[model samples]
Target: MKIGLLPLGRPTFDVPFAEEKLAAMLAALDATGHEIVGPRELLFDEAATRAAMAGLARAGIDQLLILQVTFTDASMAVAAAAGFDQPLSIWAVPEPRLGGRLRLNAFCGLNLASHALGLNGRAFSWLYADPGDDIAGDLKALLAGERPAGRLDAVPVATRSPDGARVAEALRGQKIARIGEHPVGFDTCAYTPEAVQALAGVSVDALALDDLFDTARTVPAEAAAEVRRAAEADVTGLDAVNQEELDRSLRLKAALETIRESGSYNAFAIRCWPETFTQYGGAVCGPTAMLGEGQVPCACEADVYGALTQLVLLEAAQAPVFLTDLVDMDAADNTGVVWHCGQAPISMRDDTAEATATVHTNRKQPLLYQFPLKPGPVTFLRISQAFGAPKMILSFGEMLRRPMAFTGTSGVVRFERPAGAVLADIIACGLEHHMALAYGDHRATLRAVAAELGLPLLEI
Candidate 1:
């Protein structure tokens, strides 16, 4: 792991102590088989700080630790970190002699700098100590790809261009636990147990709807409410439908959290289906949405391959991701309709204002979203295995708002293409007329994962 350290504040008069302290931290890092930077560079100069950050960004440092001394200014450092969007941790050391005036200044400045970083919404962990201890070791563990409790992020798997030998080698040994059965009549999306094993090195675990229901029964009331409030806050402009959606969204969110808490799962695939809607009343729309939003992506139709794709996306971006269905398609104008058992995170709505939640008892979890579809440029991607090969599809376009008469939350997406060639291409790809959609750009990161996996990649 490559970690960068940026110390913001005035220099301590004890240059040798500063040197020793940094060297100690570096030694601890080295013991863990990691690399460190800036133990020797005098970083008090503002330009020097900025240049270091820029260099770290270009060098592709995975984690950052900032040690604040006396200067107390954290704005510039925060700005630079924000630009890179990497994980950050801040450390505030107590003055060597707290009772003395100069010592007080060190503590005060360090405290101020950490506070500034927090106000900027930067994700950071703070350490307070006199000098040396297990603090550095603790940081090393955090950087060693540890997954904290209740924290989940998307992980990308590469399958761009594939070699028959590589595909077989990749699928020869892996397991994927799939929850629920596929949607009826949408048999195309469902995966056969053998197909999954042969093509992706995945062992499929089939689960019953009762499994989810049992998990929901044990959810604490408080946790359920918190999930509901968070889901409701994401919607701001719904008139009637929003309330219903919010009610159901909360139920699903709480239930999903409980499921993950009980199970030992690194990644999971789920079928948001008739059972979810018919037995549970509202479709598992909001919960499934939150699964992706929460970083544990659930693919519709019990598609283990799709879930694998979602997991890969989670690792690649570490942001809120969405798994959707290509319910309808319109090539006449290069447009398509994306909907499924609506389980995407409300936060991923992309709406500036809030919308109300609506509950529909007919489906799973009953939560229905009641906000305008975020209108803007967006990219769509789908990663799947075909004939023992990993495949990907990438496209971009605009999300159109539903008409006043449309029911539930629905929208049309118009993609740019040659006037008449769109439909043929879509069909040729054997895409299920339905696909997964995620917001924002992920080309570079996606490519990197693909490179690491030694697979084929296609960007359209």
Candidate 2:
């Protein structure tokens, strides 16, 4: 098979050692006699990484190797990886502490890369071997389909107490408000309220963004001030945000709260997009997070089904559920990240990582929470209609300890199944990119929900 290589390097490292690692990796690839691809020099920045990835793809490589020469940026590899369809892998060299400042954080770099790639719904291979060694052999083993054993522990399992009828009885009169239309082309958001009602006994109250925005404008100044005060009290990086941006975000919170109150809605799924940024003066992630933590269950991007899923998971686990994109995964560790653009509750923030108020990554607008999620047992579930049928995908895993791989709320979860296999099921089943994430393993409850509703379940 023709193989591609991207030797990633960071600017902070002494260029020589990184260069040596690159040269050594290239030599190893040369030994394999596969059609090796990519620039002869290593990639150090976004532009170079993009160019190398495109160049290798143009050369028609069957597999791609992301060689972490020395603790490189996750964005460089992940951004490039986003466009590639070939099997992916990361090879990192270990850095030993020898009574000096660490020369390389290559392993940590790999860990972060895995988080970003896995959360994007991409599965990748990895090896922790230095260059000029048996990396080629390891690469060939991965290419030939060998997986190391890794499993999550203490995955919480709930006793199946209530049957479908009982659970549906509890949901019979519950109503959730969904504001505005789903994001464009997100057909996963297409749901008949009757379908939800028939299966789960919940109702969707469709509302308009205009109504919410209008209500927000009329909210008393004191109310908006209270929202701002509450938001600022626990967050650590409020000082970094501009005052106008901060107030704009608070106003969004006020508007949504007012709409929720007027309708007497139990939960909301909001269109937190172009309108929030273009029409309003800020992003709605912070406000959405606050609402979700408050048990209102606001689904970003106006996904009504996702919002409902959050409510269900909340009922099962009684914890806040985050709607995240499964961006990146690592085969070696059987782990990946559930990441989104800053909407996870502050309560989920890892104690070690400061809970900072930050802007959205792409739009560079204010009001998204930025922190690594605290680690423990976790569950991921997505409710979707695929192949003309409604199904709920459920999985249990351990929220492993790791630094947040990217901006926003991210949890590093190591799954019981092979990360690649889970990704394969996602594609085979045509699952949506959005997942409802809640703490603890509620697999048993989720299974009961699926069984009671006669919906299929993909246990990945």
Error of 2 at 292 (Å): 1.2
Q: Give the residue spans of candidate 2 off by over 4 A.
A: 1-160, 163-166
Can you write out model 1's per-residue Cα lDDT over 1-460, one digit (the tens) per residue?
6777776544533555555655555555566666776434447666787787877777788787676544344455556657667776655444332111122133333333333443344445544444465555555545653412111122345434333234334434445556777653332345677765544455667767677766665667788778766755565443444444444446666776666666645456666655555565445665666566666677666766677666556654556566664433433445655544345556555355344455542332356554345666556666643222456656666776543112234445776654124333442233432355666655556565555554455544
After the best TM-score superposition of candidate 1, give how far the Cα of residue 77 lies from its true spot, in angstroms. Answer: 60
TM-score of each: 0.53, 0.67
Q: What TM-score does model 2 achieve against the real structure? A: 0.67
* Predicted candidate 2 versus true structure: per-residue lDDT over 186-298, tens digit per residue: 45566788888887778888888888777767778899889878887757777788877777788888888777777777788888877887787688899888988887788
How many residue pairs clash in all the candidates, one count each?
A: 53, 16
lDDT, model 2, position 72: 55
